[model samples]
Each structure stands twice: as structure tokens, then as C-alpha cells.
Target: MSYADVNGLSMYYREHGDAPVTEDNPALVLLHGGLSGSDDFAALVPELSAHRRVITADLQGHSHTADVDRPIRVETIGDDVAALIKHLELGKADVMGYSFGGGAALRCAIQHPDAVRKLIVVSFPFRQDGFFEDVRAQQRQMSPESAAFMKQTPAWELYERTAPRPEDFPQLVGKMGEWLQQPFDYSEEIRGLQVPTQLIFADADMYSMQHICDFWALLGGGQRDAGWDGAARPGAHQLAVLPDTTHYAISSSPALAGTAERFLR
Candidate 1:
């Protein structure tokens, strides 16, 4: 339960695994999804920390971290992660993010590549249009009023219990909805990234298979299958689609944790 003064906010972050993290075993920063908190990664953190120090943080307006005057945007939140890393005095660290956090992770890698050693993006699309038709349709129709139903969910309970202003739930939802409505495309930027990366998603993720292939292709994957000798492999970037999972369940899958562990190592 530590907080770092970053980007004009006291960002909440938790450290795990062996202390006195060193360059040989850099920390692994974990970012939770939208409307979710650092607790979302609790189950996975131990496994991750077994190999290296794991740092989990609440994104703005989630759980222990309160919202600021700025609107909810991945780019800004990503910058916040970079700031936190510097605040903690780590030279660089591997970063893993889930869902909306995945968006922030992508932004951090693009905007602060020098601060990142490896990148892991789970269950999120690079571009706004990359989401499935139904997903985009849902986002388009989402509103603060529509968010009323979420009050019955765990996200609501967590927000009410831990938010700096519990009553701000609706306001947070409203801003998130508004941000999702805007179109975004980071294809070019992702293509230019030099960081080693891993992409994980549910087989039934919000993105279509074609979209995932396109994403892999942009990262120099799917161009051609590796030969028997595995001599023609593309960049170190890799993609994994977890089995029998949806976007909601993918984050909690043991398979995701295993894949991430292997990738980070």
C-alpha cells in the first residue's frame, strides 16, 4: 500500500516479490483493467513475483487511486506509469496491462520506450476500430445512465468501498464512456516500437481473429510461419490467444499467467 507522487497525483501502487530489485531482475509492473483495481491482479501477482519483483498499481479513478482534473485517457495514464517507475528509482521494468490497462501499456511503450524493457498487452486492441462490431456498438451506446446497471457488479462495490469519493462512480463511468466513444489508431506507432513485446487475448476476445492477425502482422508476426528449424522467426514479439475464454475471463486465466511468465522471462 504505497503511493507515488506522479503526474500531479498520488498514484497507488503495491510492490511484491524479492526486495532490493536489481538490474538483473527488474520489476514487473502490473496494470488493471477499466473499473478494476490492483486487486484484480492479486491471484496472478504471486506467480509473477516468484520470478521477479511485481508492482501492481491502480489506474486513475480505480480503487485506491482517485481521479484528477484530467479526463480518463490511456495516453495520460501511461505517462503516469512511466512517472511512477522513475519515482520508484527503477531504471526500467517490464510492464503488463490488462484490457483498458492494455491500452495504457501500449501508450506507455510508445510514449516512453526508454523506460520500458519488455511489454505485455492482454485482451485489448491497438485501434478503437479493432474491437468487434458488437463491442463497438455497445461502447457507442454506453452512457452514465446505462452505467446504472453496473452498480450491482463487483466493480461498483470496489469503487464504492475504496474510491476517494465513492459517489463519483457515475462520474467516472461517464468519463470512461465518453473516452471510449472517440476513435483511435496506434498502428503506426506500435509498428515503430523497438521493445520486445507479447500479446495475449482470449480466443473469443472483443477483437476478431482477422483483427488479431492484422495486429500480429503489424508487429512483424504472421508474415510467415517459422520454418522447422525456426530460423525465419520475426521479431521477438509474440501473440497468444488463450483457449475457451472471453475478454472478461481472459485476465484471470491461469493460462494467461503462465504465458506471461514465459514471455517475461
Candidate 2:
């Protein structure tokens, strides 16, 4: 566990691989999902670290990081990351964020473009107008047994929801409960992002596939007159649908990492 004071907040992070002090071999910042902390990328880090220096951190109020007095917003989290990069003297690095962290990565790219070189967002909800209402409704429709199971089951069990043991159930429930309260909104901010971006989604993800498609289209359509090559190029902005994979595709499927590595390169 390493600590860095960023914007008056003590940020905790795990660094993997050798960070080359050259501009050519930049580091990769790995942002985990909302409920899950840097632990979410535990399995993928070894693979990603092999290619680039990897830095994973627990967001404010999650994992070992302390919570702030005010309500947490995605922009605030982005600012924290920006401060961390500046504090470390890391000029520009690639960012890969999953789920809720995906939104935060996008916010960082928009807010501090000079710090983020490339962006990769997996299973992110960019536009939250009608999307969040559906999420709220889905939460309301969850049965007591299902809700209880989610709250009590371990994250590993949640990742592999088959033959879960009694001990694993509580952690899952607690994680789900925490996710229900996390704050994230980027509908207004996403349109301002000018960095090269890639969006990845699982076929069996609970989020809207159409929305993801629309987002890719919007970003590809020249959101800012910057003329994003990924959007304009045929293969730019690769939209991969991992077959038989869930929202946690990065952990569930090893093939997803290969695809992501290629996209990042």
C-alpha cells in the first residue's frame, strides 16, 4: 500500500511493474469499478503490467481510502486522479476504467486532458438521463431473497455465482449495497472529451447495449471538431461484444484482456 496526498485527500494505490522514467514507455492507470476497489483488477494487473506500468487505486470512500465529508462526485474523483498524476510527476498516461470507474476515467480525460493520453472504458453508462431511471427501477424490482443474496455473497462468489458458500454470501451483499449508493454522472461532461477513446461491452451485460452503441456513434461523430481518429477510422473506437460474458468481463474472460491490449495499443 502506497500513499499520495492529492488535493488534501490521502490516496492509496498499488503500483505494479517497473515504471520507466521515459516519456515513450508511459504508465497505465487502472481504475476499478464502483463497489469494487483496485482489487477488481487483481487478476488482470499481471497481464497489463507486463506491457506497461500499472497503477491501481481505491477511489475515495472505497476500500482502504478514507471518505470525504462532502458527497462524492465523478468529477471530484477525476480531480483526485489528476492531482495524483501531477504529484507523481507522471506527464501523461493511459487510463482503463471499468464500470463506474469508466465514467470517472472519461471525466478525467475531459477535465485534465493533458494527463490522460488514451482512454478505455468498459461497461460504462455515459448518458444517464433515462438510463439511471431504469437502473433505479431494476433495483426496486429485486426480490428480498435476491437482494439478500447479493448483500451477503462474497465478491468472488458474485463473480462466479454458482454453488456459493455461506461465508461468501455476506461480502457480495455488502458490495452490492455499497454500489447502490455510489455517485456517477457524466452526461454533460462526456461530450467535451477530446481524447482518443475505446468502449468495450459484454453481450450479456445488464446495461443497455443500444445506449453503448449510441455513445460510440456520438463520440465517433466528431463531438468536438478535434476529429478523433478512432471515431473516423474504420477500426477506430472498437466496440467488442464478448460472447457469453457478463458485466465483469475483464475478470470472467481472459480473451477480453487480449482484445483490450490490442485496442489499447
lDDT of 1 at 149: 87
Model 2 per-residue lDDT tens digits across residues 1-265: 6889887677888789985745777788888786457777777888888867888887765665655554456677888888888887778988888877887788889899999888888887765542546666665544324544455445434334321133433343344444455555565556566777888778777577677767776665424443555444633455677778888565536866787788777
Score residue 3 of candidate 1 by CA lDDT. 88
Q: For every model shown, what is its TM-score relative to the native structure? A: 0.97, 0.77
Q: List candidate 2 segments past 4 Å from native.
A: 19-21, 129-134, 138-151, 155-189, 221-236, 249-252
Cα-lDDT of candidate 1? 0.88
Task: Highest lDDT: give the candidate number.
Answer: 1
TM-score of 1: 0.97
Which runs of model 1 end up more than 4 angstroms from their true locations? Answer: none
Worst 10 residues of 1 by lDDT: 138-147
